[model samples]
Target: MNSLKGHPKGLYLIFATSTAERFSYYGMRAIFILFLTQALLFDKELATSIYGSYTGLVYLTPLIGGYIADKYWGIRRSIRWGAVMMGLGQFLLFLSASMLHTPGWAHGLMYGGLTLLILGNGCFKPTVSSLVGQLYTPGDKRIDSAYTIFYMGVNVGAFIAPLACGYFGETGNPDDFKWGFLLAAVVILLTIVIFETQKSKYLLSPDGKQLGVLPDARQQALSAEQAKSASAGEQSSRKWRNLGILAALALVFGTLFYLWLGNDWVSVGIFTACLVFPISILLDSSLTKIERERIFVIYIIAFFVIFFWAAYEQAGASLTLFAAEQTDRVIWGWEMPASWIQSFNPLFVVLLAYIMPAFWAFLNKRNREPSSPAKQAIGLLLLSLGYLFICFGVKDVQAGTKVNLMWLTGLYFIHTMGEIALSPIGLSMVNKLTPLRFASLMMGLWYLSMATANKFAGMLGGLYPEAGKEKILLGFRIETMYDFFMIFVIMSGIAALILFLLSKKLRQMMHGVE
Candidate 1:
């Protein structure tokens, strides 16, 4: 079956699966920091560090998962097993929360749960997203629109999970946290059931074969041919040797950073890998001049994206803490759950996702559309503006005095607009620019930016000022909320300006893909 717009039924099936999975992931995230600080009694800095590590590892594993899916297990198997691991991970979290009175047991359980979630996310995230790209053919104009709708589905899950899970978990009782974790587990199980049952019936390629299955003999032969073509040069062997050396260097740097920096090892490792892997690829003698330039463009845009996401992802850490501690949550004589604020960005995404595609269509029809790199620059600008909004909004408010909830709400709205401008488009850009032979690998590399961003977000979140405490970062004093928010304003604003200046050149380097 096809929609009136001619998108296949498989799109909706994948949408449903992704929506439920996101619900599980985001629901857990909604309460994770609160659970740590309130239930386990961890400090704000420690909890945020752990939160960053967990989130960063979640993106990091996709590199491994995408490879396994492409080479051996296929998408369906990887997703299934991944779902199981995630379900178990959530269950462990529930158990951890349930044992909150036993601090030692709960702490052990919490680490165990986080490890599993990281492993599971590595398997599920990239493969499912790649599956969405598979649903559309090359040069399909609807691809962006399809991703927009798919992104809405993601927000639908994100929008609801916080409200539902937060209500259950944050009712002023430490023990209540288990309810949220349990809810996450149940939704993930539901996702697996829906995906396994319906995939055979509705999920199919454009040629009518079932989707997510392992490659057959003929497909394997073709992949081998493509690989051969990609490596057909005298320097192929040397490039492989260089890649190994880079990998070793990455590992060594990662270990040293871990030993020196405490909990930030994952971020350091991912940043190292992101830097090394691209240089190794650029050194590949088989790549054409065009391919090399395109790859360079990807790397350039990816670097700017790191700044964007580091600012944007504060929602899960510093922003969440801000809502809980500083922002006024009372409305019309009712005190709202702090986690309810988690719904705001997704709610805005749901509202704006519909508008953006149409807005872009209007622009494209008139030949007035900005290129992907240009739009991303706009996104970083909006993110900077969002933080600046908060900076000014809270400038008059004293510490320990709650401000209007609208301040946070307005910020999320602006941030969501920035997200719409950047996130979905980045996915489309990667799929369009990558060569077929390196598609899965390139997608993993794209996610590496996210991994670095998330860890960086955590590091920033760790800087959040505690009550009556002055925090200093990079020789600057963060003596007030205004100062904290101003950090992002300066960082994202500068990055956006630089990206805007480079957009024209990056667009040219894309070789007219758009």
Candidate 2:
């Protein structure tokens, strides 16, 4: 049952599921900060911080979700549960918006909704991504191209989300935001219905085995025993060592949370477990030398990913603010919604996704393709260029004067190109390089990088110049928007240069995987 140009039937199913899920997520995100500021009356700093914390936790929880899928729940069950949770979350947000006049209740409902969304995203994001990897066999050349197509599905949802959600949410009185959240819930329910109906027919491996089915308890125990024997020839001792590590990590995190975050035990516990689980895996005694090298490459790339995402994810926070406050968004005598700018990246993605795989295929045929690391380096360079374009375009603009919309649109185009070069490629890289036994867990670790980046993005967004407010960040006085934009230009440019310089060494560490 080949569909989508000879890809497996399951590929399209995953694509649909991913697309709908992204629609739900990006739709809410498109108006989240604006809703906070305009409807809830939160300041920019507070809204950005909440945005950062919400997104950060959304990525962070995937570590636990992925581990559960790997060990017990399996991908299918995890995804279903995640969809339900996210639907509930969206509904809560809808209720929150409905109660906009009731500040206390609305605030509580909003936080509760955010928490559920974070948890649901953890379960949904990594498992679905791992399943996509499962659709192809090891060493399949088509995997990269398949991820590219899947990523295009992601952008399809992202592109439509703001246009649909933003229109209803932003066009009317501020109180109308509930309709958008309600729409997101409806779309997510539709996604669940589609997947539940079609999965039995289409979601299968190449060998015709059902994908994402959990093993029986007996089989799971056997596999656990095998892993223990492989690790140190002593199951009990290894279990104790792992438990000790977890306990120690919990204690450390608990202390930190008490001291720094006003005793936020939930955050402490979740982050502690996220950090500890990966360390335990990396310390496993059974890894082959080649496996260790490949894993090390993943870690190195994950480090660089933090920088990449820190800048790229500004689209949701700082860039959104810029669109609302600085960019001239009038089109044909009507002022466009600020969230409409959120659509530009995905629009460029839809355009470029078609061109990129063919470009890479051409390079491959001629034996001239750049290594994945090199492509990622180029992506960072492009990201820097995007920010530099904004910096230069806004250099002379005054605080009250709106810059041309082209500046923001052009920046999104360049950033979209950068994203195409890096984001899907990074997903493919993790799937390709991960040991099969740790597939979901490793994917979770990959998202952990995003977790860190998102938190940093929030911090950066907080630095965005408020009207008539000047502040010093990293010793630079950000009196104008240009100064704020230049920080990203400098940061991403240096990161790109460093990555380009180190690409050769990183490629060597891949042990010929690419």
lDDT of 2 by residue, 1-514 (tens): 5556768879889999999999999999999998999999998888888888888888888988988888889888889999999999999999999999899999999999999999899999999998887888789888998899899999999999999999989875889999999999999998899889998888887888888887222123334544656445476687788889777886886777668656544445444554566677777666678888888888777778778888998998889989998888989999999998999999899999979878888999999988998888889999999999988789988778999999999999999999999999999999998887788888999998888788778878888888666668868787788988888888888988988898899899899899
User: Clash number for every model?
Assistant: 0, 0
TM for every model, in the order presented, reads 0.94, 0.94
List residue ranges in candidate 1 displaced over 4 A. 1-4, 215-236, 251-263, 280-286
The digit string of per-residue lDDT tens for model 1 on 1-514 reads 5443678888898889989999999999999999999999999988988988888888888877877777777888888999999999999999999998789999999999999999898888877777777777788887887778888889999999999999999999999999999999999999999999998877677778777787222243444444666544645677678878887878777777777676655667777776776676676555678988888888899999999988898898888889999888888899999898999999999999989878988999999999999999999999999999888789968878888888898899999999999999988888788765455667777888888888888888888978766789889988788988999999999999999999999999999888
Predictions: Cα RMSD each: 2.5, 2.6
Instruction: List lDDT for all candidates, in order.
Output: 0.86, 0.86
Error of 2 at 45 (Å): 0.4
